[model samples]
Target: MLGTASPTRAWLLVEEPGPWGAGGVPESRLGPEVTESLRRTASALSARLLLVRRPGQAREDDGVRTLFRVTCTRGRERVLVRTCAAADVAAAAADDDGWTERPGNLLLVCTHGRKDWCCALRGRPVAQALAALAPDDVWECSHLGGDRFAASVLTLPTGWTYGRVDATDAVDLVAATAAGRVLPALARGRCSEAMVAQAADVHARLALGVDDVAALRPVAARRDGEDEALWHVDLADAPASAAPGGVLRVTVRRTAGSEAALLTCGAAQEQHPPAWDLVALVARQLPAG
Candidate 1:
């Protein structure tokens, strides 16, 4: 997988795996159904997703660069897209039939290009660790974080983006997301609007200094003084509060089984508004915490 998906030009599209396609995203990340979920994620944030080469396939774009095209689907319906990334062609090997590939090969990206501090320095280790853990799936990106986050790891099979991830969180994240778990809270930052909401809710709970954050979202905030990012989530029918008989009685472990950062915060909402950020804020006022 590594050999074919060139790290230099591979454009990894990190977004929330959708439940078919409400703007193309899932209601809640599939956790218990890790083995059964297969989402068709898109490069929502970008106008065009970078296409990697198909395993054993290649093409030239106006003679300047080689491109690859491939398709994957949630079920029988397949989504079509392309990438000028040469490595994408080989990323095909990362594909699995489902059950056996929990944590399907990973593609950890450490590029912080989205942020002003996104230098090769921060992205280097993220790339190295991902490569070391899932060499076949890992690809040191050219600053994909698109933010100042120290590190960001996105799972290839699940399209879940665990932000503020540290070298330590790698193992658990790789295992959980690889298995298709819906890591509640932590500002999901998966680039998937839904996931981002999840992350913010979790962060909001942390900020208010409460743990009973039932279906919370950051909405928007000025992080410890970093870029203004956004966060969102939907425990819509959550319990009135984290109390008995409450609609939601949730206990989310922001950290993955591996104990890494999973530091999902309102990283995105801090900078911009998400699809449901406004709704989340209004809901937050209801005193659900």
Candidate 2:
């Protein structure tokens, strides 16, 4: 079984020119001290740390020129900073209000073998395939959690996370994403929203046949019971004739499996994790008075 998809709030990318080995991104490239500092900073900021590099030939240089990108969905911000060492990332992570509002997108394929074998075994091929399709936009990033869902992908700027992806699905995923559509079957959820909102977004997308990435936005979310939540979402930029002020209410219930299993390979067995189930969906169109 695959790992459950969850939402994330932000992403932190660090550029490292590499000839990445089977072990994944070489921490040796970043040096021991800088590596430690980067890990600490990323954890403190609750950011997913990724290693990125421009596709193609490796440049001959003794020192690495790193570029750091911080992506936040709260204000729709993407900030980029250039530095000579990985240790410098701390300062950028420390800044709370320095992100620039812009549209920046990247395809991050997790291949962190040290963290989990499935990631390297299942993720590398997908990354290579995607790179062939969009060289400038694809990258082999570090762990993005959910090792059980190896070959997990995070589409940036929009922060849509997908799991259990394979090489065969790379082309269609890229095409759909480029056309501003979300693939519900493979989609985990957007990192920008909460868990219930993520589930609601998926349900709404499938119900309305709405594909645009930014078409639906969460208006409100609230708990209705100990294990159930309701979400109100608005359909943005819809045709007036189709939906006069389109809105949807989605109900999601939290459920648990009867068995315990390892969340990821090499991890101890644990109680079943909570899973969300879509119970009902209601669409409303306000009268244009």
Candidate 3:
């Protein structure tokens, strides 16, 4: 699941403390017209609409809802919150007022069972584990893609999505994020970046032994003109005492999996998802200033 993270730079998480259908928001109790309007708003903002709730069976509608808009625009990451009724939540997407800026990060664990059985089976325990550590920061979110990679966790403001996470390591993962470091082993990719950039970023992080989430940023990515399988990506490194102006270049090849299989529980047929392989990695020094 290296480069399989969903590609979305912005996210609109609506607090819907109730059951979610296989289709998530559309199937939730948000009503048909409201759901469509929310979908349009999300599409207009290039954001994903995720239904989120506090962990467990405390599903009583209190006539109040919290809406969060998180933007993972690389260096300009930020989270905005708005409190409004469920009926008026969609209007908050484009509205410029009444939004409070929030700091730190948000942990979203997929527990939308209707979407896929694996999610409910594996995601809930992980969510419980994480919420135990950071009650205010953790949420049971709707489908996060890659159902086969259940127990998927996404950290907001940075858009770092993790896959195949276990309940035992949930605290470690959240602690790592709080400390501004990344657990590379379970990372799927950052939702804000393209697939090639995601693959390259992970490869660069591993190759350089850098775990800090802010240590490297994707500077450029391009596909080979002659070969669709080849991609070239460059990452800009943050200033450091050892290497002030450093850049890392990564080359990756995209190929199909050796065998097709069921990627999600809801799928009726099997297919092969694209796989990214690291070809080469090189670190270069910038010319003297």
Candidate 4:
């Protein structure tokens, strides 16, 4: 799951109190017109729109819903919140004036069982466990991709994602996130970056023993030569003994899997997913002016 984080940097999480269908928002109670409108608005903003519901049986849509708009841009990360009648969700999301900036973060657990059984079976427990620790900050959300990586969790504003997480791991992750640090062991990648940059960022962090969320930053990424499968990524490290210039470069290669495998329980046929490999890592210091 190294570079598998969803590629969107912006998200519009609309509270639906679902039992969402396999298609997520489009198949929910919000009918085609509203869903289409929302899809258009989200697409215009380059945002991912997902349905969210509170954990447990007590959750019921009371006509009014809370919405969260989050952008995970590296230096300008922010979360905005607003409450509106369920019918006005699309309008509210498109309106920029009424939103208020919110502090803290959100933990979205993928539990859309209709999309994939592994998600509901494995993700529910993680969501419940997380809600027990921070009720207001956790929600059971629709499909987040990578179904085989069940019990997947996505932290908002930061866009840090984790997979194969259990109840214990959930607690630790919440604590780590609250403390503004990333638990690298279970991390998939950050959604704010491209796949190559995500893989390189994870590698750089572990290589430098850096866990602080703001320590290692992706400076630039580019395809290597004419090969689409090869990439070179540069990250700005916090001033450290390893590099006086605080720069690290990582090279990565992408390759298709050798064999097809059952990736999701809902899949009709086996499929092969691509893999990313680290080619080289170098820390270089720049000349002083």
Candidate 5:
């Protein structure tokens, strides 16, 4: 209300969906789960104000000088509302609320990079749909470092990356993420600091082990669901032993399966264990990402 901004905040209103509001924009669905999650999160955070809309509203600056505007529809009636940003337009979806809800960096990126009819493809639809639904969260990017993946929306708070998303599932994705629920099909996975720095060596390829290396790939991992249990891994490597001169010949493995488990294995590799760290011993016989 006084500073350079108005504390990024969002105001959400529950409404039914209908046809295009005005500009012939498409429609966005507010699936039951998505809607419930949004409400739950908004209530938990005590959100005072939020912009609400249906899909198909043009997500852009229609010329509101002060706050950010993300429009949507209530069955053909074009609805335009102001975003949280009290100063900068980019803070539209934020700046007003107490900053409690997660997905910290809520970014709606448009992956439709190439300036051609293709730009209007899925990327544009995603851009417009998200813009209409959560327009303030819209972002213009050349690329998110992937091919055919036009936009990359980075939900603040958690750095989960989703690719190939479009207008249709925008609401579902946003709502699911806000609820801290894992959208397995949507996550691009997260790699840890240890995993990023690992370039371990293969010490000895043991034959008398409980498991053997088969196929390996660089994977981002983490523990989830009932298995507070770490990931279970299956690895294979060439038969090897300590170097004739002295050193052992082992292969470092790239991991898959669970993230927490992979991290556990990666960490174990550091402790030069005689046999305690099974992951390190097993990893020594694989590849890297």
Candidate 6:
């Protein structure tokens, strides 16, 4: 449960009304060929493939109205394909003309039971709780890469991933999303950046106490050594109280996990997962204006 699940850079979501099996989307109604193809496509793009269902009764002609939504930092792409066929998915995911720059937000809760029981048990309640608060903005989504972090939450349009969340955390999460801030305590990382960058972003957020989602943006990164990296983050449109010429330098290194355990309950005990630790944090002061 201590492993980082923040490596994804993009996400491909397919609408599937189910009866999803124990393995979730992979074993869902979408045939094995299409599922496998999706897995490969996602891997090629460093993205995560997920199955999503809008809240309500399962559609009778689910396959005919399947929706494919691709979200990346560059833009949000969507297409409505008539079938759950693999070829269609490939074309849609690859189609550049279909992508558009639009501002929208969505809360995706991981409730993929087939991937791990904990996700379903822990995530469903949180999803329901959040959905009650923002009915149109929330959806029960498939595996989000962290089975150990059962109640994993992904905030889209920004792709901020949070894990180990509970029903009680819904209010804060919703508020944070609406206000363009992130809760550092549960934040796994931002999907758009590398793990090192993700750590650096969190460090900067804590040091500056800047919660506005658009406040800090990674401008550059450099390697300090094999295990460490320095990230240059620029603060945009910061409040006057934030200080002059806003910029923050964050250094992060890989650290040891507190202990080793299977990342998921269903996984064999032989598997070990690494924990996230902050190695260093420093604020770079700017010259007076």
lDDT string for model 1 (128-231, tens) is 66556666556443234334345655444334445555666656655654554434333343342333334444443443344332233223332223323332
Q: Clashing pairs in model 6?
A: 22-114, 180-213
lDDT of 5 by residue, 1-289 (tens): 0001112223233222221121111222434354345446545544322222323434453433222222111111112334332123333333344333222234444332233223235555676666665655554333233232334443432333455576687787756654644343443322111222112211122223211212122233333244432322322322334222122222333333232221111133322211111233332323444
- Tell me which residue pairs clash in candidate 3: none
- Range of the 10 consecutive residues with the lowest summed lDDT in candidate 5: 1-10
Task: Check candidate 4 and list the clashing pairs.
Answer: none
The CA root-mean-square deviation of candidate 4, after full C-alpha superposition on the true structure, stands at 1.9
Better of 1 and 3 by TM-score: 3
After superposition, which runs of candidate 4 have C-alpha atoms over 4 Å from their true positions?
24-26, 226-228, 258-260, 287-289
Q: Alpha-carbon error at 96 in model 4, in Å?
A: 1.9
Q: Estimate every model's Cα lDDT from 0 to 1.
A: 0.35, 0.68, 0.86, 0.85, 0.33, 0.68
Q: Pick the candidate with the highest TM-score.
A: 4
Which 10 residues in a row give candidate 3 its minimum summed lDDT?
237-246
**Where's the lowest-lDDT run of ten residues in candidate 4?**
237-246
TM-scores for all candidates? 0.41, 0.77, 0.92, 0.93, 0.33, 0.77
Candidate 3 lDDT over residue span 1-289, tens digit each:
7888999999988887876886855387777777787788788878999989998667668888989889998888999998897778767756878999999999999999988889989999999999889989999998888998898999998999999999999878989989988888888999999988988888777766778888678888889899989999877874364245677778999999767978887789999977899998766677689
For candidate 6, the clash count comes to 2
- Cα lDDT tens digits, model 2, 239-259, are 344455676667776668566
Candidate 6 stretches greater than 4 Å from native: 1-3, 22-25, 36-47, 55-66, 74-103, 225-243, 268-272, 285-289
Better candidate number, 2 or 4, judged by lDDT: 4
RMSD of 5: 18.9
Rank by TM-score (best first): 4, 3, 6, 2, 1, 5
